[model samples]
Target: MNRVKYIFFGILTFSVINLYPQINRVMGMGGLTYAITDIDYSLTPYNFGGNPAWIVVDEEETLLDITPNFQNSWGNYRRMYDSEGAINYGTAFKGVKRLSSKGTFVGFTSYNYEVVRNLYRTLRKDAYTGEAYYMIDTTQGDFRYTGPVVGLTYSWEMFNDLFIGVSGTYQITDGLKQVYTNAQSIFREVSINAGLAYRLSNDFVIASNIKYSDFQETIEAKDVNLLDVEVYNYKGDTYFIGKRGSSVTQKLNKKRFEYRGQVYVKPTEKLSFAIIGNIIPEIAKVLVPQNSLIDVEEVYTDFYTIDIQAKSQYQLFENTLLGLKVGYNNKNGWSNNSKKNLLMWDWNISDFYYGLGTSYKFDFIPMLIGAEFEISSIKADSSKYIDSRFTNVSASNNRIRVGAEYELFEDHFIRAGFNYGNDEVDVLYGGSDVKKLGVSAGFGFRLSSAIYVNANVQYRKVSTEYGGSLSRGGLSSFITLRLNTF
Candidate 1:
């Protein structure tokens, strides 16, 4: 005999989830290199001083950078299953050209590209009872996204002792995912930035910037299916079989807006400080199966993220510099469906991080050295959720890095460095933790006064307390050449 059971399963569970450090020199130092100019302009859209001022008559410079990275990771989920020996590799390119002519106003354009850099996951569950009975249940999925970004910036002297700059960037990403169902998505991002720098005097300068960004993503899924079956023994030699079926289609959307501001001050030739703030508000909408399990309804989720950071640097001597950075990031989620007793829900996450760094240049040896140490305290809050009403979980991360650069000849360089870090994220996973260690070396050669080539190699390993480990070691090379109108 055969029996059929209809499982009113709502197919509404939608889940969604690297700058390599160093050119030739910083990779050897442990991947902790910091620059006020890169941090300010790259993150906040504020240019400290124009790369080339409005008055300078030197030819504009064009820069090219290429970076490729590889990683191998192994981990255990719920301590019940483990994925071992997974490898990931990706490559990124950036090119920037100054469009303004020599002895004229300054403007530039840039482009960035990345290839085949995405993630995939799978899950399967099965249950069966009785002799000669078997059941199979499985689901596999892939989330792939790639981006091409274009940016433009213009800077000119507004007046004597004052400067102004404006920049804009537009990015588009193609997102594709296939579970038991197939989905296609598109994401768009736009940013605009404006900044002003005023030199009150030679001893002091003030700079500030304001930036706005908009992000939107839409996803459509078709033909999602789920299956559950049971086989049991009847009386003597008779057997019975039972089966359930579920299928669905869904549409999901996410929209987010962000605003950022930064302020920088250099009160003296050797002292400088900067502060940055960011605020982001996000909304998510998705189609979910109704309680009866036959109809679909729309659900909304809201969340906000805020980040604040402060950094300061001091030149202790003519050849030595020291700096410190501190930051706090917070995320809060609110749910209005308080009455629904669901097994899974959303929670909030927060992280606080601080670090100290120092660099030194030897006047006599023609070499440079740098080092940094950092710590982060991470916490996950889910007390408001029904499943985690009683317990709170927390973790911490600690890291250290050191590197050095030596001039092998005039305009030629060689460098090497090593780093170690511990991510204590298993506080609730039987108190087991993960550790990371890596070492790297590289060399650079100047083909001409304006052309340079750099290459580097790194050996890295990640090991868990459950006897699972991952290793990634490979050779990566990139060339940087500049065009000048000298």
Candidate 2:
């Protein structure tokens, strides 16, 4: 009995944190293979997986295997379960280059600027409110924690044809929520990302990547008012039923890292197609069973996914181009995550994006170059998030971004862009729109004929309601260097 109370206390009071059953239909869905970026080689913080499956041996070499079970419903269904974190982001870099007649090539290509923040801050309000609550569960002692976080990302070319990258991040001192438990506590951990690509043809490429995320936070027991009374003649049941207040703290952590990929091909000189997909096998679902349970084991899962996209670009005239892209993703369903099917009849939520863009140049306008106009729709299903509050809603994200670059000097340049995505999701409470803006500038200096240096700076803003109450704004920054621009 003491042990169960202690565990519940650890879960509820442990951290300033932060999912779930569904049969994993995809293999290699829960490994750290995709979240990392090859923005630099100096540091490797994350990876996306496509590697041969192998059990990552722990201290005792206990072969950790997660299975799916639908039995959470009065033991009717049982599925493999475990905590799985999956993430991925990618962009196409198209550049027009200068190739010489002497069998020499020299040109520039601009890929999506993946500026993993060296570090960023997250300021929040309302982290400490509501409950007259005493500890129901965790390891980190009492007192809600809240503060800003610092994140870093590194990406660089690997094996000439591959790009490997990782992100390393930690928070200052937050009583944020825990990963596996609801308790409050201080949290710290690292995640990994990795990627690989092969140029299939002059106008085609295929890549696979993975990412990792692991966080741990501790919680402590809280004291609350109890019913002071004696029942009937049973003297043995005379113990205090008030809330528990213990100094002992408990730890709740999460290890979510998985891999996925994208494949691109050009069917014509101006037409391209791609397929993108990722996996999230198991999301942690905690049950106290009774007030006596101490700690619970995290369940992992297996799942699969499929995504396809098509894009086309056309030269509208000299220095002007137009592009269009469309896509669709489908999940066949997994056993553990099959509960997602519960809401399948209610709404469909799959990660998908489609858009059209146009760019024009003004080479004749004294440094007043061209600009680009783009509009896109990003749609998703909340059930896959493995949560109740996030379920029941078919969310659609709509966005628009306009970008321009101007040369300050012959070699130095300045650029800026603004984008916005409104949450078209159906939720129980609020939140539907988000405004965003991006500003960036870069410098290019030539030290010699063969070596050059490029440095860039970018700032991004996200404006919306902070908690349920206060309205706030979030910002992110990035810096990059291209030592050898081919």
Candidate 3:
């Protein structure tokens, strides 16, 4: 009887219905559709200043979603100032609504709490720096961060063939160290994005987007112990100025602007293509408090970057899909010390990526399978004026992903995926010969006509050639409710 049942199930085809899944369905498929030219059931439209003018044309149903997630990781083969392990927990809320007949409104908010264990050196949120003009200490301790982020977006049809949209976001976080020298940090960021899309015809659309952002972070470290704390203020990778004090404070400020253009073409019902181009410029400044009335400028950096990508998707056969993607990025930056009238460092980096993916829906089974292969190359060059040192490095990385989804019964779906990757060298951590593996599983079920629940779990492991390993895990679940009024 069991053999008969298995044979019967194998003869029938299955389909997955989103009906309002918690996360994007593509994520369950190892993000195979990320570079696909289709926006339906995909989040590609939200990239690069969002080009949100397409929201009204892409989705019509109103939805409200709430998600709670937890993630944890432990690692010893990490960056110089990185944490040994960390825990992160967060919850998010999102809503979409149609305004009258011509406009769409989207709003989202999230809160997160993070615990970083055994962190060392720097007190910056992003430690991927030029190894210049930063303060560091030898003490290792734990840190806690709590933050809230909020955003709003609105899009509308301005004319028969023209659409416009705007969005704004604000984020603030507070971080504190648990051990001496005790440090406290406050970070804030605000950004705005605006875009316009014009439908030249039913088969072609063009869009342009612009974004601006401002960021600030302030850090203060103080020790209550009778002995003064000693720290190093770096001037370059190999040179530093040493200081001993009971208290130290620093501030960082940054501003960035971006411009993007996109063209989307659908020549036929089965073929679609998209191309995007972007330019960004940024400036950052670091300052150290010298006295009650004086603040010294430590370093200033200016950056320029350019990015371009193209993607295409074709429905080769009835149930077979193919996607191709290619992208390139280049960035150049220089850091200077105005007070000392010297150029500290100059850096340049370039990256190239190519990917191919395919998906097939089985005719005689209730399953859809997808696989993707990608390769990337990165090259970096740096020059330090103080030491007259020049260095150049290059690395290559390759990755493979496979995923499958099956329908167990009506309104019930299950998915599983696996990923593997190898990096000749880790650019950020300077690790040689890195290998990573990841596995994920997820399920979705409908509770009623308007409510649905979805959950997923993921695990990953990393190993380096020098006998160092790391393990990470995450779990996420969300409830989505929909309402229709017409």
All candidates' lDDT scores? Answer: 0.50, 0.33, 0.73
RMSD of each: 10.5, 16.1, 9.7
For 307-326, candidate 2 gives per-residue lDDT tens digits of 55454556556566666656
lDDT of 1 at 246: 41
Winner on TM-score between 1 and 2 is 1
Off by over 4 Å in 1: 1-25, 34-138, 141-147, 159-164, 175-182, 194-210, 221-252, 287-297, 335-346, 384-390, 426-432, 466-486
Lowest lDDT 10-mer window, candidate 3? 4-13
Residue 272 displacement in candidate 2 (angstroms): 4.8
Give me candidate 3's TM-score against the actual structure.
0.88
* Model 1 residue 93 distance off true place after TM-score fit, in angstroms: 5.3
Off by over 4 Å in 3: 1-24, 34-49, 224-230, 243-246, 290-294, 387-389, 466-486
Model 1: per-residue Cα lDDT over 412-458, one tens digit each: 88878888888776332323366768788877777876566666666
Best by TM-score: 3
- Cα lDDT, model 1, residue 414: 85
